[model samples]
Each structure stands twice: as C-alpha cells, then as structure tokens.
Target chain A: MSLAELIEQRRFVGREFLVWLWFESELFEGRFSLDALGACELWLEGQITLVQEKEQSRLKGAAPSSAPEAHEALRQGKLPSQARVRVTRGELEYAFLFNADAFALAGVKIPSVVKDAADEQFYERMYLIEELETLFTALYGEFLALRLSAAWETGVAPFVRAWVRGEPVDVAAYQKLRGKLAPVRGAARSRTTPPPAQAPERAARVVA
Target chain B: MGALKGSISFSKFYVRGELPDGFRDRFAERIQLRAFRPLTVEEDAEQRAGWCSIENPLDCELDHGKIFFNSYLNLGLRTDRWQVPSALFKAHFAEAEREHLAKRGREKLGRREKEELRAVVSRKLRAQLMPVMKVVDLSWNLEAGVVRFWNQSPRAHEGLAELFEDTFELDLVPESPYTAARELGLTSEQLAAFEVLKPTVFHAESTLGGAR
Candidate 1:
C-alpha cells in the first residue's frame, strides 16, 4: 500500500507501538517521525513479500530432507523478508526485513532542534550527548536510574551515529527528546549570569 | 532619541519653500552626514581656461550628499512615497551612489555574484530605512521588489511612503509571506535527502529465536 494510505489506515496507532517496533527490530531508533515511517512504508511496498511455511502431509511427497533440515524448513530457516507497518494516526511508515544482526544493538535517542518547519519533509540534526542527557534528565528527572536505563536502551547508540553523521531520526522521538530537554535548557539559561563589563584597558588586553 | 543607533537613507520631499526654518536647523544639527573621500580632478589648460579649474569650478558640482539626494528622490518617485528630509536623504543617497560607482569598478563576475549583490543592496536599504520610519513590523521581498510597511496605525503609512521613496530609488511594494525559512547550514542536496528518508517505520514479523 502507498505510505499515505497505510498511514491513514493506521492513523489511530500509538507512538509507543511504533517506538517498540523500531527498537525491537533494528535497535537503531535513530530519528523517528511519521514522515520517515511513511517513506519506509512506500519503499517497502516496492520491495517485500510475505511467505507462509507449511509441511508436506503425504509420504508421496518423498522422504524428509533430514531431521534438522525438516525442522529448519518448518521454521522457514533464515528467509529473506520485508514488511511495512504504519503507525501513529497513519502518519508514519516502518519498513523492515528479517535480515542482518545490525538491529540487535541498543536503541539510541538524540535531541533535535526544529531548525526549519517550512519544509516539513526535512529537519536539521544536532547530536550533543550533553544536550540529549540534559533533555532526558529534565523529562524523566524524577525517575532516576530506571529512566536512564530506558534512555540508554532506546536512545543512546542510534542517536550517536545519526548525530555524528548528521542524519535525520524518527520525528516523534525527536519531538519527545526535545520536550524532555526543554526544562533543562530553560533552567540552564536561567541559572547563568551575564559577565560584568571591564575597564577599556582590560578589554583591550583581552582582545589582544 | 539616541540618534536612532543606525544609518538612515532618505528620498523625496514636496516642500512649499525652503524647509521650515526650525525643521532645517534641527535636521542639519541632529543628522550627521558621513563624508566621502573627495574626487581627484585632472588639471588641463583648456579645462582651466573654461573655469573648470580648482579656483573656479563648474556651476553645479557633485558632492556625496547631492548624489544621495538625487538617487533618494528618484527612489521615492518610483515607489510613490516620501519619507526622507533633505539632510537624511542626501546622506543615504551619497552612500548608495558611492557603492554603485565602486560596484561598476569590478571587472569579472557570474550570475551568482550579480544576484548576491542585488540581495545585499536590498538588505542594506531595508535595514537603514526600517529604523527611521519607526516601523515596528515590516516585511521585505527582494525577488518581487517590494517592501510592506506595516504598523498598528494607518496614518503612519502616509508619511513613511513619502520618506521611504525620497531615500531609496526602489519601489516599495507591499505584500507579506506567512512564513520564511531560516538557513541552518545544510546543503540543498542534504536537505532533500533528509526529507525523503526521514519517515521509516519498522515492524518485527516474527521472534528472533522463533520461540513463539
């Protein structure tokens, strides 16, 4: 199905489900957004197929290939596959395939700044670990160690790679991270004081 | 009150007589005209004989202020507004003319340079004029050649249009965009790529170990 259609169909889906799917599948919860999901769905529609495994019931079919082979074949041993799932009010598309162990790592979460909104299709990415930590710390400040672990599991690794390479992440996660970090940023701003003015000579010396 | 803290450019004026005595004096004293380097004149026997020499020059000599005033007046006429007085108008006109002359001195450039120059001029004019008009809210369009002067009061627009036209020689048309994009240091290609791959959703079809 087209991304728009899929998103529309799954528009009622929650962000948590999408987050869980992304985390469990790729473990690379880079930037997350509905648009990213939609694009993935569109891309997957052009690439994947679903296959079901069924055993040959009759002896006429011939002897089983081997004990382990029969068992492996029954489980569809390492089949190449792809699927597109829509989530969050049908606003995002998640495309995935049953291949590669790259998605086994912990999820990464990065803080995002909404640099431009006119082109809702693309966003600016900044990956300052401190910024991410500050945001999470502010959002779940009360949760202590549990929240930190959750953040590590869901946000650290993916966020680092995405931020270092300056790649986009899931939009929803980006927004959530920003929301989490807002209070911390505000507190930092409030706590800081402007430097006092110095004598002209001192200023000149500093400049020199 | 504190000299407005920025540059001011002026354009057209329809004075009944010599600018009202008090207005002229206040403008002359309060408005400081930034001076330009004097132009070098070549001495020739024929030129000297015709009274074009240093002692007795032409009847009407060009100063930075005069050039600024003329350009500012021309800009006012084009935009159908007048916001500059003789003093402020002359100062801005001179600056613009000098810049224009300097630009003409360049030898080679491409389309991008030309576009950049135009954008720079547009931005400079806007920056200088916006402050003088006391315009708190305004929008500028470089491509369309328009500047929308907006305020809570309608009467302010009348005087501003005239003052603006008198200062800059460009027409100040009025229209505003709902929003504008702020640059974030990303290349156009990167922005395009980010837009395309930004939305991807992943799903797990089956368990990793196939326990379920």
Candidate 2:
C-alpha cells in the first residue's frame, strides 16, 4: 500500500491519536500548514535515506578503496569470490551491499502484509502526523527488541562463555556470531574509564 | 535513486527455560547510555527563538533512545543481530522507490501511472526466477545490482532455484553458487569473521533548557 493510504488508515484512534493531537497542537499551536507537514514528510524520508546510505556503505566489500577493486572486478567479469551470509530469526528480510572489510545492512522493505496494515492506519485523525511519529518510535524500539532477542538466542550466549573462560576463540567463528559484540570490543578497548553506573530501570530495559 | 530497498524476514524460536548466566547483566550493560551535559539555555534560545518558544526550560527533555546493533558470523550460518520492523521497512522502501523514480525523471507521472509502473517493475522482477524460500537477508549494492538476496536457508535454496527456473523460464544455477561467489569476495578471511556491532545508540537526556 502507498504511504498516504497507510497514514490515512492508522490515524490514531481514541486516546492515542488524541494525545498525539494534543501534543502536536501544543507544539505547532494551530500554525500547522500543509507545507510544514510536507516538510516533515521530507525530513522523515531524508532520515530513511541517510540510514540506507550508511548501511550500503558499510557492507563488506563496499569500502572506499575496494570500490575500485569491485569495479575492476566487475569490469574484468570476475564475479565476487566471497559471499557473506546473514541469518536472523523471524520473517524479516534485509538488503545489503558488501565490501571486503564491511557490509552495510542497507535498507529494509517490509512485506505487503505489514505495509498494508501500516498504510491502512496511516492517517485517520487530524493529528495523524503526530501519531505517526509515535508509531515510528515504537516501531524502532520493536526492531531493537527483535535484534537483541535474536542475538541472545544465536550468538551472545556462545560468545560470553568463550570470553569469560579466556578460551582461544576462533576470531573468525566469533565474527560469524551476531549482535553488537564485535564493535563493543572496540568500544570497550578505546575506553580508559569504566562505564558509568547504570540505573536499575535503564539496565532492565536493556536486558529485557 | 540511491535509496535502498528490501524486506526483513525472521523466524521465532523458543529456548527452554533455565536462564543463561550473566545474560541479563550483559544486556543491561549494553543498553545503558552515558550521560552528557544538557545544552545550555543560551544555545537553545539562539536556535529556536522564532520557531518555538519554551515557557519552562527545566521541564523540557529530549528522548533519543534508538538502539542499533550488528554482528559478525561464519560464512554459511545465520546470525540474529537486529530485526527491522515491517512498518519502517515499507516506509523506507516506498520513500526510496519514490526518490529513485524522481531521480530518473519519472516524478511527473500521474499517481495511477506511478502505481502502474511500480506494479509492472515489481512483477517483472519477481518473475525473474525462484520462489523465495527463506530470505536470509536483503541488501542493496550501490555499485552493482540494486538488490541481492542470499539464499542460505535450505528451504530458500531449494525453493528459489526451482521458482526461478519455472517463473523466468531460464536456466538458473543453484542458490549456493551465488553464495559461494559472495564468500569468495571476502578473501581476507573477513567474511568468516562476522562481527555484530552497534550502529547507533539513542538516549533521552533530561535537559535544563527549553527550546526558546
């Protein structure tokens, strides 16, 4: 379904939409205009674009230096020799661009079922835009939850055991593991100070 | 035109109860956010003076709490690092397709025409071969093809190859060939060392200043 249609259908009903309208009304103060709304649309679209670009550039073989190599490889009619496999739980699909050192998780195009539901609820109330903002936030949160859960099931448990035991981990095998473990090592090493004490609530959210 | 497109496909599995040790603690530690000084009032006033005025400075706070994660894994196995929501995924695709069309000077088409074109393209692509088995992951290579699917799942490998052969009426190699090529591209032993990394971390900081 189209975005406009999605917005129309999902226009917040009841308190959800009303709360959004109230908040937006307070923020825009009745000064909202179609142009402003259009601008917001563009801004949101732009964010998706940025995220997509970041993902594409991040792929394994898509590095700056390697782009030339990739081009030459393509020009020489040499198909890419190595392929990376990305596995996740659930019925989600991802598109990726790859380079030797990195692979970007480019963009996500959801299935029609999800798209239709979202479009159906896109804009039912005058405060539809505000409702959408909330929806996007919630959707992102859900995405993170899915990722964390999947990682725990697939990679985290294995990695933690290896790390704690000081076992000689096959770095290659670990790389094949999922979640944010690889980067965390880099981040942790760069830090001289210990991580700040986390609040109980915030900590719970992360673990949950 | 540079917008990327694809879908997020995942499956759910249950682990028998008996919690893993330190799992909770490590997860909590990863999700925690570091503190940062709030933007001073003077800075805020300069930025939103005309656009928005804040009546209560102390009452204003911004919540930026989006967590992005990634992983590194072996060549053939699947790793669960992150899940992209269906809603956001479609939105991104629609937005990207629109941008791509606009870049190609196709933006002037009527709404119906645009829809027709999109349908035609999607149909043509889908028909090219293969029933989608398990979509291991989707990605866009800005340099080569706009989209590529890795068929590592046994079901996908078996299904897609036959689908492609029947649908497109072309002789297509098994999905493993494509995967093998992908593996070859990562000769640095890098493909085998799949690492999960966090892309972005969002936080909600309680600020001392208001917009105005």
Candidate 3:
C-alpha cells in the first residue's frame, strides 16, 4: 500500500492502543513497570471521549473512563478517540489530552518548573516533554509487542473482551500470559522477532 | 506562550532528508526571503503566510539570532487574510449596486457589472479594515529531526508542510500511528503489520440488549 493509504488505514491501531491502555491500567491498578522507566503510573482521568462515527459519549470527572456510560459506549462499537491521561514516574508527572488518530498532544501540563533562567527553562521543559514521550512510547511499544503476536488473539483479546463486558477477569492467567509476552531482550519489540508459537493459559484481573 | 514557556499544545512531525553543510547560514538567508509581507489593497492575494519572530509576531526581519536557539530552530508561522464580514459586504454591495444603477440610469445590472461592483466594494472595505492575523510557533530539533508545531488544525499542518518544504527543501511526515510507530524503530515487518491489523470490536460483537 502507498504510505498515505497505509497510514490512513491503520488509524485504528492507535485507537486500539488506547483501549489496551485503558484495560491494562485497570488490570495493573494504574502502575506499570517498564524497561526504561522502571516503575511508573498512568491512568485515564478527566475528560474521556468514546466515539463511533456520529455517535459519541463525552464523560467528565476524576475518573471518566470508569463510568458505566464509557463502557456502554465501548460496548456499542465505539472506541476512545481522545482522552485526558495522567502519567507519573518517580517525582515527575505529566498530564495531557492524547489524540488517538493523530498521535498529537494538547493541553500538556508538564511537571513544575525547576530552572529559573529563560533558556534553561526552555531546555528543562523540552526535556520533561521528551521524557514523557519516551515513557509513553515505551508503554506503546509494550502494547505493540503484544498486539503483533499470536498472543493477542490467544491471550489478550479474550481478557479485553471480558473486561469490556464488566465481567471479572482471572488474575493468574493474565499475569502468566503477560510474563510470556514480554519483549525479548537485545531486539526490537516489533515484527523483527519471530512471533510466539502459542499462547499459554491467560487471565485478567480488572481493577475497575 | 510557545516552546519557550507556559503550557504546551502541539502536533509533532518527523523531518526527512539530511541537512546539508552550512544549513544554519542557508536557513537564515531563506527565512528572510520567506518572511511575512504585509497585505495591501493593490495585491490580489487574499491571504499570505510566512515566517516571523516567535517572540514578536510583528518582527518579520528574521535573522540568525531569532531563528536559532542552541540546538533548536524556532520561528512563527504567521498568516494574514483580508476578509470582509459577509453581512457588511452584502450591505456595502447593495449600496454600491444601487448607486451604480442610479448613475447608469438602469433598473437592473448585468452579471459583469455586479461582479465589478463587488470587487469595488471589497477594495473600499479593505482600505477601512486590516487583515486578520494569526501566528503559530514552530520549533524544530535539528538533531532529532522532529518538528513541533503549535497549531494542530489541518490547515496549519498543510501550511507548515508546504512552507517547510519550500523553505528547507525537506519533506515532513506528520506524526500518525504509522509514522510514530516507525519512529519507535518498528521493523519493516512490524510496519507492514500496521496495514494488516483490523480494529478490535471488543464487547461490541455481542451486545447486551441488541445490535447497536
């Protein structure tokens, strides 16, 4: 496919990534251990927009994604188009509206200013923003790894389906599957590596 | 507020192609050439967009100091458009049409006459009003080959891409799922998977009440 056609057709990838993020945030109770950042926290908070073409649900509050209406919208073939996400790692915290289709960041509230000088502050700001991007991309990399593997169909998809239905997820099975799905070391977390041959037992424990 | 300070909002793009040697000097020279030129009644162009000072939009004399900040190159994309409000234009057009008809001793005007009168009305209004001005900041990290534009609208994206390519002679790939994934070092196979994967229906395949 042409580059433009490829990009246009894969817009759903980002939307699904948002879904996976929502499900995983609930599964891990807002904490994630990453290869680069070690331990970090991320959650869907504030405004949430679930949309399917002309139909859309806008929920607002501290934890909008947890609302019943949000899930109902998801159950009706709607996906999160944009969301207000808060991410924290160690002492640093950043919050912004993530546009799923475009991978754009808006209303980004970075961590507090530490440097007072003009140029220094700009550098510091850019550093914090890039730090957030790195953290976010690392999380997305994990999702992409699971997404491209057979494990998505055999392991993650079932758990995600159960979670969206508001049904309880089995914890042990999911942890085991996640363990096996971890990106192999010294290689990219993409289609570069051979796909896993099979999926072991899988389960998911939803915090929501 | 822009990349320099305050809260941030931006659309990211990946820069393609290698910068030639002496790019800094070359970029400074081109920035001045593309600097915003004020709108005038004589000009038929309704809108014009070009580079300006990120600190001061009115400072169109772009130079090395204003265009570069350490490893980053920063400038403002300023666009000015001449527009007469539809209601005011209609009212002025009707008045002008009536006056023209009275002077010509005619009850009705031909299509060409009306068109000419409309142009005349626009010119008269242009003399009374200034063009609408908008400025958006653009910051490019030369080392990273990434650009963050302050505006996220499609029009702004097009403007940035067109102006950037025209000025720097480089293509810019706007950050999308595919582009962002590629930037993450996705393998060729992984990138191809982008086209194969389909949207997951989640629980929608089995609706609780009925088909939605």
Candidate 4:
C-alpha cells in the first residue's frame, strides 16, 4: 500500500490509542510509573471531544472524561478524537489538548521555567515538552505492544469492555496481563495472531 | 513561532534521510541563502514564505550562532502577503479607473484595461501600506530528528515543509499513528500489525449512545 493509503487507513489506531490510554489511566487510578520518568499522574481534564462520523460531543469541565455523557458517547460508538490532558510529576504540571488522530499536542501549558536567562528558558521549555512527549510515547508504545499481542484479545479488550459497560474489573488481573507486555522497542518475538472472531469487542460495535 | 513566548501550539514532523558529513556549514549557508526577504510593491507575487531568525523575525540575517542552541537548530518561518482590503481596494481602484479614463477621454475601461489600472492603483496604495506578516518558529532537535513547527495550520505546515525541504535537503513526515509508532521504536512485527489494526469497541453489547 502507498504510504498515504496506509496512513489514511490506519487513522483509527490514533483514536484507539487514546481510548487505551484512558482505559489504563482510569484502571491504574492515574498513578503511572514508566521506565523513563519514574512516577507521574496523568488524566483527562478540562475538555474532551468524541466523534463517530458526523456526530460529535464536545464536553468541557474539570473532568469530562469521567462524565456519564462520555461513557454514553462511548457506548454509542464514539471515540475520543481530542482531549485536554493534565500530567503532573512532583512539583511540575503540564496540561494540553491532545489531538488523538494526529497525535499532536496543542495549547500546551508547561511547568513554569524558573531560569533567569532567555536561552535557559528556551532549553527548559524544550526539555519539558520532550518530557511530556516521552510520557506520551511510553504509553503509546505500551499500547501498541499490547494491541498487537494475543493478550489484547484474551485479556485487555474484555477488561475494557467491562469498564465501558460500567462493570467492576479485577485490577490485579489487569496488572498481571500488563506485566506480560514486552517493551515496544525490543526484538520482535513471534506470536500467533488469534482469529478476529475470538475477540468480540474488536468485531462488534455498540449500536445506537 | 513560540520558542520564546506565546500560548504553545504546534504540529510535529519527523525528519527522514541522513544529513551529509559536514552538515552545519552547508546547512547554515543554505539557511542564509533562503532567509526571509521583505516584499516589494513592484513584485507580482502576493506572498512569500522563507526562513528568518527565530529570535527576531525582523532580523533576517541568519548565522550558525543564531540558528543553533545546544542540540537544537531553530529558525522562523515568516510569511509576508499583500492583503489589500477589498472595500478599500475597490474604492481606490474606482478612483484610479475614473482618473485614467477621464485622462484618456474614454467613457468606459475594457476588462484588460481595468485589470491593469487596478494593478497600478494597488501598487500606488501598497507603497503607503505594509504587507500582512506572520512568523512561526521552527525548532529542530538534531539528535532526535524531530521538527516542532510552532503552528498547526495546514497552510503553515505546507509552507514550512516546502521551505524546509528546499533549504535542508531532507523530507519531513508529520507525526501520525504509524510514524509515531516507528519513532517509538516498534518491532518489525508490531509495525506490520500497525498496518491492519482495526478500531476497538469498548462496549460491544451496548447500543450506540445507550447510556444516555
């Protein structure tokens, strides 16, 4: 396939990535520890936009992701296309609207740069933005690794389905499955692809 | 654009292709060659996009010292366009057209004549005005092969890509799901799967908008 064709066809993965991140964030209760940056808090905040074709819901508030309308949109097959996200680590706070389809960050509010020099501020801003990208990349890398694995069909999707349906999920079970996730940049280990039929959630959409 | 100050916004692009061995000098020379030039009223071109000093757009004199900061290479993509207000232009053109026709002892101007007269009037009016100008910051993290263009508009992206490719001799692919995955260092198999992956339905049994 042409690069353009591949990019156009694979656009859905961007929204799926956002949903996966939201799922993990809620599951882990906003506490995340990654290899690059030890521990941080991440969550959707301020605003969120979900869309399915021409229909769209733009929710704005302190916690739009946690609202019933958000789940309602999800239940209706809408996926988050963009969201305001806040990430805090120690004394720093970074907030921005994440454009999921493009994987672009907008209206970014980085932690204050306390440096005295202009060059220092520039470097600090760049560093802070890179740090933000690192966190996002780590989460996306993990999501991509899991999404391509057998565990996605046998484990993650089911758990996510339960959560979407407003059912209780075993957090420990999830932790165990995620524990098996391989580093995205590691060598490609052979894994059998399960028949798509095996994962009902991957095949079936919620009918409005 | 925003390296110094503003509400931060941008679209990121990943640089592809290798740079030549002695890149800094060649790059700096090319940057100076393509540096932003102010518009002249005599030109037919309505607008132009070119490289400039990221620190000060007005300071178009670019050198290695101005472009480089630590590991990052920064430049401003400044665009200047003649944006004569329509109402103002029409009123002025009407006056110019009247004077030309009256001086020639003619009742009406032909299509071609009207166009030429309009251009003349535009040139005269333009000399007294400034072209609409905008500057967007373009910062390249050399080690990472990432270019953060401090503007998200499609037009800006196109202008930057065109100017960047022409100046740096490298292609830029915007950050997308696949590209981002590649940048994150996905394995071959995972990268291949990225091609065929489908959307997930988090609530399969529920009807669309059922919760509402």
Candidate 5:
C-alpha cells in the first residue's frame, strides 16, 4: 500500500492508544509497573478533545485526569485526538499537549528550572528536553509490552472491551494490582491526592 | 515550545527500512543547500510550487554524549491571478478588444484574441506578485530512527517524507500507537491479535476489570 494509505490504516491505532491511556489513568490512577518500562506515573491534565466524526461532534473536558464525561464520550464511540497530560518520573515532571493523530507534543513544560546557571542553562534545557523524549519513548515501550503480551487477547482485551462498552469490569486479579498501587488515604497519601471534584457530570473523581 | 529556544511545534515520525551503504553521502546530496529561486506561475493557474532545503546539513551538534542533526525544507509558491483586480482586467481587455476591432475592423475581439489578452495580463500580474515561502525543520537522532519535524501541516509532512524517500530510499512511518507496539518486536500470536485489535471502551465500574 502507498504511504498515505498505510498511515490512514493506522489512524485507529492512535485513537485506541488514547483510549487505552484514559482507561489506564482512570483505572489505576496512572501508576503502572512493567518489566520493560519499570514504574511510571502518568496523568491526564488540563484540556482534552474527543472527536466522533460520524456523530459530527467534538466533546471536550478539562483537568482531573479521571473525567467521567471524557470516559462517557469514549464509551459513546468518541476517541481523543488531543490531550494535555503530565508525566512524572523521579524528580522530573513534564507536561505537554499531546496530539494522537500526529503523535506531536506542544506547549511542553519541563521540570524545575535550573536556577541562575547562565552558561549551563542551554545544555540543561537540552538535557531536559531529551530526557522528556526518552520518557515518551519508554512509555510507548510499556504500552507495547502490554499490547503484545499473551494476556491481551486471553484477558486484557476483553476486559478493556467490556469497560469501553460501559459494562462493569470486576476482574479480581487486576483489582488486586490496582489496590496495591493505590496510595494509602492519609498523611502518606498526599502525593497521590485525588484530583478535586469538578462539575457533577464532568467530575473525574477517582473512586477508591 | 520547541526542542530549543525560539523554535516551536513539531511532528514525530518513526524511521523504517535500513539506510543504504554510504548513507551520509547520499543524504548530503539530497539536502545540499541551494540558492532561492522564484516559482514559475503559469498564466491563469491559481498557484505554482517548488521546494528545496534551506541549509546544507542543517545543523549538527553533540550534547551529553548524543548527536543531533537538524534540517529544514522550504516550500515556495506563487499565485498567477489572485491579486489582479477583475476591474483592471476588464479595462485592459476592453482596450485590447478596441485595438483588435480597429485593426481588423471587427465588432468584437475573437475568443483567441481575448485568451491572448488574458495570458498577457496574467503574466504581468504574476510578475508583480511575490512568492510565499514556508519552512519546516527536521530533527534526527543520528543513532535512532527518530525524526521530529517542526511543523504538523499534512502537506509539509508528506512533502518531507517524499523528499526523505527520494534522498535516502528509506520510509518514514508515523509512530502511531499500534505501529510503535508492533515495532517493539511482536511474536506471531501478538501480530495476529494486533491485526484484529478493536477499540475498547472505558466504563467507570470497570476499574477493576483486568484483575483476573
């Protein structure tokens, strides 16, 4: 097939990836450990755009990574084309608007600034940008791990399928993993504080 | 913000296919800088286009043990008749018709005469109009097949991809989530599953759905 045709054929995959990300964040609160990618934290932050071409409607929601409305739209066959997300690893945090169709990043905010080191600032900035790219690469690597795993067809696919259809998902084993990943709800949990509740239908509350 | 100061926006592509022998030499031939040339706008045509690299080797630098290469592709276009006012054309055509009628003793200029006049006017107008130039930056990792273009325009992306293929005979695939996953080394079974992969929905109640 021609290159354009090939790219068009893979468009759905990009949309699915966004959906997977939404599922991962809402279900596990953005905590996952993969043998290949190790422990990584991701959260959908700021604005998100979900497009449903057949319906000719674009649904948008902002902040609180767990937006139920966004999930609702996804359940209704809408897929995210763009999202503002925050990714954290160790002491570094990178926030950017990610475009699913183009796999592009814009308005990226790198981790804490390197203070007053004029001559070193240039190199430091480059280092941080490269680091962010590496993190993105690794995240994709993790997705590939789960996506290609045998469990995907045997179980995970069906699990995600059911969730996408607005059906209840209570597979106990995944729940145990989530529970283990969930932060303890007191003083020790401030770091993983649930995003503040939003408007009634739009609220992205992470149900414990 | 861009990968560096003063730069903004970029689109990502995953490089596929092996670089042929003497890749650098071949790449240099394709990306060598050229003097700016004006686009040749055909009469009555809406626009004409041509493109070339803005700089040779673009830029190469090393930072923290990694090498980065950047290049830019510039596309230029010229309009033939867009800026010429219809009134001016009408006036010119009227004068041309009058001259034709007087010379040939005919009441009106023939279709050929009118066409000829239009061509003249179009050419004149095109000479007065300036060409528009668009620049898209390319960032490549010397070791990895990662290419980040500083523009998301579909036309620009396709153009750059075509240029790269022509230059290095390598294909550029968009690292869409699925393609990326497949490239990460898939087994036969996984490949089969991927072929039939379907979009999954996320339900609020399904937070614990994958535990089994």
Candidate 6:
C-alpha cells in the first residue's frame, strides 16, 4: 500500500489514542507516574469536542475534563476530536488544543519565555517548543508501552470496558495494571514536586 | 526564514529516500524563475506553481545544510458571460453587431463565433487581472530526514506534499502516533497489540489548577 493509504488506514489510532488518554487522565485522576519521568498531570481544559461522524453529531463541552457530560458523550460512542489540554510537570505548565486527526497542536501556550539577553530569544523559543514536544513524546511512549504489554488484555482492558459501559469498575484491578506499567524510555527523572491532590468529588465521578 | 524566531506552528514529516545526484545544484536550477512571458489565453488551463528560495531572492542556492523556500501557486478565472450586466452587454452587443455588419457585411453571428469573441474579450480582461497568490514555507533538513511545513491546513498540506514529491522525488510521511509506533520497530505481536488497544478511562482525582 502507498504511504498515504497507510496513513489513512491508521488515522483511527490517533483518535483512539486521544480517547485513551482521556480515559487514563480520568482513571488515574490526572496524575500518571511514568517509570522515570516522575509524576505528571494532564487535564482536559478550555473546550472539548467529541464527534460521532457516523451519527453526524458532535458534543461540545467547555467544562473541565472531569465533566460528566463529556463522559456521557463517550458512553454514547463519540471520540474526542479536539480538546484543549494542559500538561503540568514540576512547576511548569503547557497548554494547547490538540487535533487528533492531524496530530497537530495548535494555539500552544508554553510557560512564559523569560530571557534577559536579546540574542537568546530565538534559542529560548526553540527550547520551549522542544520541551513541550518532549513532554508529549514521553506521554505517548508511556501509552505505547502499556498498550502493547501482555497485561493490557488481561488487566487494563476489562476495567476500561466496565467503565465505558457505565458499570461499576474494579479499582483494585485497575491499580494492579497501573502498578505494572514501566517508565517510558528516556523519561526525565528529576521532577521534585509532589503529585497534585485530587478533590473528593473528582473521585466520586468514577463511582457516579 | 532567517533564524527560527517566534512561536512556530508547523507539521512534521519523516522524509524518505536518499538525495538524488547533484541534488543541491539541480534544486537551485529548478527553482529559478524565468523571465515574464504572458500566457496564451487560448489555453483554458495553466498552472502557475513553482518553488523559489526565500533567502536568496536574486539567486537560488542551498548555501548550508538547511534550505528554506516558498512554494508559490497562482490560479486565475474569468467572469462568466451570464454574470455580466445583461442590459449593458445587450446594448453593447447590438452596437458591436451593427458595426460588424457595416464593416464586413455580415448578418447574425453563429453561437460558436459569438462564444469565440466572448472568450477573446474575457482573456483580454483577465490579462489585466492577477492569479490568486499562495505562499507557504518549507524547511528541509536533508541529513536529518525531517521537513517542517508552515501550513497545516488540508488543502495546503496536499499542495505541499505534491510539490515536495515533484521537487525532491521523495515520499514524506506525516509522523502521527501510528507512524511513530511503526518507527519504534516493535515485534509482530507488539504491533498486533498496538492495533487492538482500546481507550482506558483513568479515574485520577481533580485539582489540576489547585495548589498541591
């Protein structure tokens, strides 16, 4: 098959990856610890757009990632197409609208570029872009590792199935899978901040 | 095009195939713009698409490992006869017909003949007009097998891909999660698992913006 044909055939992988990230963000309560990258938090913020192309319908939610409506749309068989997401590592935060179809991050708002020297301005911007790309690559690497693992079918898939079906998910089973996840390759290990605390109501969403 | 300044929005692609013989010199020759020669109006279709180096406007050269150029394209269309002011065209046509009859002793003109005349007039008017301009930046790191394009819109991407293929004779595969997975060089079983992996909902608690 041609390269274009191959890409077209595999476009759903990106869509599924986005949806899976949403699932992980919610399941792990936004804080995921890659083997060596320390703990990082990812949140769906600003705007979320869920699309069901077959149904010719789209659900848009400006609410936070934890919003029930967004989950409800997922239950109705919609996949996230575009979402504004914030990724926090250490004391830094980067926000961008990710489009799954194109695998493009738009309107990226990196942490402020503070430079005293005028000549260093270009290098600073490039560094920021590379930093953000590295963070995203680390997350993707973690997802890939978990996805291809032997435990995925035996452990992780069942919990996700139960959750998507609106059934009572087995948290113990989910935690077991999480425990087995290895650190992504080349993940940074120097982050020092503690994982952010989760609200009580946020935990309730899983049960609700 | 100069220094990679400011926040850049681009699409990344994995370049395929080795550079052809005399690539830099041939590339420089390919992008040089020819002197202006007006296009024939008789031809219904003409493509004003080519590449020109952004840095050296006067000459085309890839001085360093990196080459930045603008893919330029232009398209032109004439106003339809039906879109012309009906009353005004009718009056003008009548006067022209009278003048033609007096000059050449012709009666009524045939449909094809009238169309030919209309096309000639449309071409004349269109000559004074300009084609729509489209310019997009491309930075190719020949050794790194990476290319970054400024425009990510679907149409522009298609055009860029086609232009790149035409120029370099190489395939540019967009690096997506799927393609990135392929690049990892996984085993067959792992590849199968990658294909079937479904979404998991992580139920981690909220407080994304709150103090830890």
Each model's DockQ score: 0.02, 0.03, 0.25, 0.25, 0.18, 0.11
Task: Give a tens-digit lDDT track for model 2, residues B143-169.
Answer: 121222343344644443343333223
lDDT of candidate 1 over A1-208, digit per residue (tens)? 4423432332212222222333322323232222111111111112222223332211111222122332232234222122232211133222222111111101122233333431110111111222222222222221111112335324533442342222344545534553453111121111111111210111111111
Score each candidate by Cα lDDT.
0.26, 0.26, 0.81, 0.80, 0.56, 0.58
What is the Cα-based TM-score of model 4?
0.90
CAPRI-wise, candidate 5 is incorrect
Supply the DockQ value of model 6: 0.11
lDDT of 2 by residue, A87-124 (tens): 11133222222221111222223222221221122111
- Who wins the TM-score comparison? 4
Candidate 5 residue lDDT tens string, B1-212: 23334434667777788767876555554444222233565645553322333232212221211221222122221111245677876887677668877888888766887788778767776677654445454556444566666667787677677666665577888766555555555567666666666554443334344334
Candidate 1 chain B TM?
Answer: 0.20
> Which residues of candidate 4, in runs, are more than 4 Å off?
A186-208, B206-212
TM-score of each: 0.16, 0.17, 0.89, 0.90, 0.67, 0.69
Which whole-number lDDT from 0 to 100 does residue A47 have in model 4? 93
Alpha carbon deviation, residue B34, candidate 4 (Å): 0.5
For residues B1-212, write the lDDT of model 1, one tens digit per residue: 00011121111112222333454234322222211112212211111011011111221232323222110110111111223355754565556556765778854545776565544544444445522212222222222222323232335455455444443333332211000000112235432332332222122222121111
TM-score (C-alpha) between model 5 and the true structure: 0.67
Can you write out model 6's per-residue Cα lDDT over A1-208, one digit (the tens) per residue?
A: 5556666666666666687677778766788775655778987888877777755234445645567777777777777888888899897789888878777777777777675442244335444655666677667767667677877655565565556655565666566667777634444422121122210111111110
Evaluation by lDDT, superior candidate among 3 and 5 = 3
User: What's the count of clashing pairs in each model shown?
Assistant: 47, 77, 2, 7, 5, 17
lDDT of 5 by residue, A1-208 (tens): 5545545665666666666677777667787554433566888877888887855234445563356676677667677888887888777888888888766777778775543432233334445666676566555555554554555544465667666765655646555433333221110111111111210122131232
Real contacts retained, model 4: 0.53
Q: What is the CA-based DockQ of model 2?
A: 0.03
Q: Fraction of reference contacts reproduced per prediction?
A: 0.00, 0.03, 0.47, 0.53, 0.32, 0.15
Q: Model 2 interface RMSD, in angstroms?
A: 26.0
DockQ of candidate 1, scored on C-alphas against the true complex (2 decimals): 0.02
Quote the positional error of residue A37 for candidate 3 in Å. Answer: 1.6
